[model samples]
Target: MTCDYDVVIIGGGIIGSSLAAHLASEKNEKFKIAVINSTGLGMPASEAAAGLLTPFQLNELENPVRKDFCFKSFEYFPEFFETITSGSSAKHIDLGYRQAGSLYLIFSNSEFSQKENETRNLKTIEPRLSFLSKVEIPKYEPLITRDVIGAYHYPSEAYINNPKFLKAIYLYCIENKVEFLNTTVKKLNISSNIVENIVLDNGQVISAGKFVFCNGVWANNFLKEIFNTDKNIIKAIRGEIICVKALHAMPLRKIIFCSNGYMLPRPATNAFETDSVLIGSTSDEVDLDKIQPPLSNTVSGISSLINLFKTLVPDYKDYLVSGCWAGLRPQTKDNLPVIGKIPEIENLYCSLGHYRNGILTGPFSGKILKDLILENSTEYNIEPFQINRLFETQIRGIPKYASI
Candidate 1:
């Protein structure tokens, strides 16, 4: 009764790839691991993300639990990347990791006053946090529009190239002999509260000692299929982003945050590469099944993003439009990520509903899940992100804003 693989991980996005990297990095024993992706590698949200790692600016630090979760993940980035890139071919991959800091633009005096007080208190936690005057904003980012009144700056915030980060981890897993199958899991074979194996779309049955679902928005379908519940646990929030390239090298100094959207520099990886900026996003709730990958950007979405670009850097209005794309982010009713073993299914686990923090939290979440899979214990307190808590809470209507 030997299993084909020690672990079969469903989904190949950042979450799944990070988990694969973690499992592959195990020093004690080599586990037979497989990562299955229905969509192409790094297809949606992972690649489509603006890659802005500004957890402190967006009311993320308001909640103690969420603040701790995000900050811990933020601090773990260097070590996570180090571990994955140590022996992999992706060591040379430019993950676009930047610590240039993040700025939140202010349009009015009232808004400035409000943030001034907010930053005053936040400074206790982040000593470097400050509100830059309109006269001083240009010193940090000269390309910005003159219409901006001021901005709130968090010097320690950082960002990364989401796609390359995913690629780095994928390569690490491949280098460690983790198998990747580009296919969909059609069903699961559960017997007496334990998952025996997974059934693929082609009717191929693959046995595995353990199963982990990191399929993002698609987890809802799997949940309903496995638990036989009609409740909607995971919601798909579609986001659209546009990339604009400057004719000349107009390097952006820091990430920009505005009421309408955000702007971040997409640094040139090579000498021949030109400077570009990524502007995002519009959040629209869509049905789980409604999203077919290769998502297109709408005229309205593009126009809105363009307006954001113009408002942020009016001087860059003539910049070339390089590309536009969309992605679906998975979120739970509570907006906290789900990361733990499924109590009902002995060998089943999940790391879904990451929403906006997937890029920031993926690696640590993977570490936590890996610990739970091996020893049923973890260093971090994931009690708030448990799956059982989701089932205990009643389903609620989708909020006006899913994630910030």
Candidate 2:
């Protein structure tokens, strides 16, 4: 059967673009690939992200599978960032990649002891991290609030200028001859058990051998419509960030993280060209009862972030507010990403539900998906991320679309 392309990837965010780039750059194989996005590049999560790459900070006991996945993905960033930036079209792109590490602040004595144990256990996976005394905390971040009882430093962690990184990857994908279509996928044309065609918003039908959903939170509705499964496996969690420029030198050289949220030092935008710090965020799950919620900054969200800054940074008044924005993260029921192919639907694959770690895991997930499509193998076992697990734990009822 002749198809328009070998693969049709929906979504132009980090995951979709990365997959497009990886597939197009395969050494011996040439496959026609197209990336379709309703909105232009970086409209939602990818643009509003702070690009913190600290998977070591995750609590292993909480969700070990996700933690392990994040650590592996974080380890791949250095090489991944280098490769994407080295592309001919991406030569001038400055990703603002930094390995300055992250400080997880401890607030109470119990919290300090808890983190001490956590850091001790973390040494097996990440030996570069070390716990710091309250007195020693100021030595690392002079501007940290005195209320900190202690802190843990993950030296191997890093961050990037997300906007520039996305731009570079997008340009690199285009340079590699990956076509990007700016249109919304209205529906999936299915026959038997496979998706044979993608219907666009403009009533155009695109046929492809394989279809991958990298549309993040939007995938929830897409999956529901195509499979007739009403399960809300993925939902949008809105996160808000406030950008502040320093009046003097930069606030801190490293990322400061507390229980509530974290602060990131980001490169100044081209428009302003000033030193800036990013304070974020509020994880508000979208009310499923409402119509699709528009991504917008709210006064209450900004105020909550301001309170976080006041609690974490000393002399927070020294910084002037620059800007604020919000993005929706595709959070899953188990808080782990959904990867691999759909069980019943042949040639249908998904790499969504990344929540907050989308940017951190984007490169590696892309590589994994590319391997699955080309070599039919993966470096990491992807069974744990299969979409079937969502149906396996179905206490409410069987999946609405279950073919049984």
Candidate 3:
């Protein structure tokens, strides 16, 4: 089949946008690229994330490959932001990029001992990390409650304003001449395991030499519909976050992580005047059929977060509730992302199932996908993230705090 474009990327989230930006920026504008999305950029999880970039907090013992990938991606953020902002007309975009560090609070003596043992090894991986005693913890974050215990402070960790970053990438892609179609992909017309064309819901058939799916949880349905393979690779895990205006005399200086949940302090910006903090999230693995929004704002979820805040900070009652929102994370069975070519399909690729760290790892995932598409050599081995691995073992449910 003759192709209209060299590549058709489905999904306008961060991953897809990053891939389009990278591919469009190639020398000579070699490839014709189109990005298709049902909703515009930052829809779903991309916009609803806390934008924490601390990969070291993930469970390295269980999924070392994902941990390594996230760490490398976290390291690439500074340069990635610079490149996207420098190339686009939107030079003054504020990404809320901050290296304010993260504190993982410990509440019990047993937990403190465990962290102490882990810290010895963590120092080798993250040299700037330190174990702060209960007395020292308040010195860093004065608002923290005097709940008798210690904490681990990772000074190298950081965060970004995810929504702004997504917008910047979209603008950067446009500046680089990447076309975008605001539509839904109805089907993939495949013959002999090679996708020949993509059928849209509007009755338009688009042809592309190559196709990449970055559509998050929707990819599972797409795969089942196209291949008739019920490989349950991606599941939608709903996470609800609450945003509140900070009432503290001094704003939270760093990311605060506790056993129950974590909070991110977003400083006042030109767009939003009041300094606010995000308290999240409830990871509920709901049935895909019931995944539609009005994603139930339960009293239990909100109350749990409130109680956690009260436990962590004495002045938790001071912060007034602003609003609450929810997004479905494309969590994989193994808690690792699916980011490679399908074994049975040629010219078809996937970069989905990023779960909680999508924003953190999206750029590096894009680079990896680009390298795979262009057949360029990559420094990291991506074998562990392949789709075939799901068939090899029983898919396990990831705990809510597995990555924390």
Candidate 4:
């Protein structure tokens, strides 16, 4: 069947772009697919993210979709990297993927409870997770705070340069002949409960057989009004981070976290290896209009992290920071993303509300969204993150907190 366009995807972030790439890669027939975005991927929270792709969780097994996709995507990065950086001469610009593994430490009561048997079920979460004691700490994480008592490792997950990852998707999409429309979608041109096309900000209309909404944080308002569905699937949260020229040699290998803050290795080239530790972030849930967080808040957030680092690793006491920022993460009420087509709106899908896991689950999120559009079985279950889950209940006026 000759179709005008196979799909019209909204939002060119990691999720949308990845989906476009995956769809084209898996295309058995010709497909005219287009991806639209306001600011594109890695622009806000995704770009400012620590880019730690791990299945490491505090137990109870978070959204199964996210967990499964995280591991799947981790295994998929090497190939994705090769495909995207095949011709780029610039070394650092090439997909910055490093399988440094992740080190998850357990501290405090609630934190301990959640992480207690997590390592035991490490195989379920991540096959490579192993317990580490004080003695083994130095061998693994030499620069980490000496106060670290309990920890585990997940070697499968890789730390990514998120911006490059997004760029790679852009390259992959362009390479695959996926069209990009750099505009915000005003509304779904829906009639009789079917999304026929999308109205752009400038009144230009584009048609599609399948419509996927991958815009984070901004999806809620769109959903409520477009479908008249009051499902609160996205929670806007602000995260503050500081790029301290890794300030210290830093015993941390993959990702390090204490009570106050967590840090990840920066990807972009910097003056010093120790100078590029991406220290973050204050997880403050706020309204969409209040998306931009305060710089003072970012500074204080870094300071708090420094204080905690001092207690854990005294070497980071007088470190100098290079950059500081705050970004928004689109969390959901259930702390899981919504990643399937809305039953109410046929051919209209959603892969949003990923919050901090956009980098971790970005690739797989794209993979699954592709499967849904192509009518193939997804690699993992999609029920957990169904967009309609929250709307099942009448959630009234109480504010909620963000979950990591």
Worst lDDT run of 10 residues, candidate 3, spans: 395-404
lDDT of each residue in 1-404, candidate 4, tens digit only: 34458888878777787788888787744678888887632346667787776656434557655566666766776665665566233234635567887777665557666676555666765555677786787787777765656676677656777876787778767777888878888877666667777788899877878888888777877776754556555887878776765443643567775556677776544443343677766887766654433323455566775565566556775466677776778888777778887765556788888877787777777877777778746767887777656675553221121111
Every model's TM-score: 0.93, 0.93, 0.92, 0.83
Superior candidate under lDDT, 1 versus 3:
1
lDDT of all predictions: 0.82, 0.83, 0.81, 0.69
lDDT of 3 by residue, 1-404 (tens): 46889999999888899888878777345568999988732346888888889886774255767778888899887878888989897678666888999999998989777767766866887888988888998888888877867889999888888888899999999888788999899888777667889999889999998999999877877766544455566888888888878776578889998768898887776764788888888888867775455566678888887777777778877889898877779987788998887656667888999999999999988888888888745566888887766653442321111222
Answer with 1 or 4, whichever has the higher TM-score: 1
**Model 4: what TM-score?**
0.83
Model 4 global lDDT (CA atoms, 0 to 1): 0.69
Candidate 4's C-alpha runs over 4 A off are: 1-4, 28-30, 40-42, 61-66, 76-79, 86-93, 106-116, 123-128, 229-231, 246-252, 267-275, 290-300, 376-379, 393-404
Q: At residue 360, what lDDT does model 2 achieve?
A: 96
How many steric overlaps are in each model, in order?
A: 0, 0, 0, 11
Best by lDDT: 2
- After TM-score superposition, what is the CA distance of residue 115 in candidate 1 from its true location, in Å? 1.8
Reference-based lDDT, residue 316, model 4: 70
Task: Sort the predicted structures by lDDT, highest score first.
Answer: 2, 1, 3, 4
TM-score of 2: 0.93
Model 1 Cα lDDT, one tens digit per residue, 62-108: 55777778888888877998898777888777778889998899999
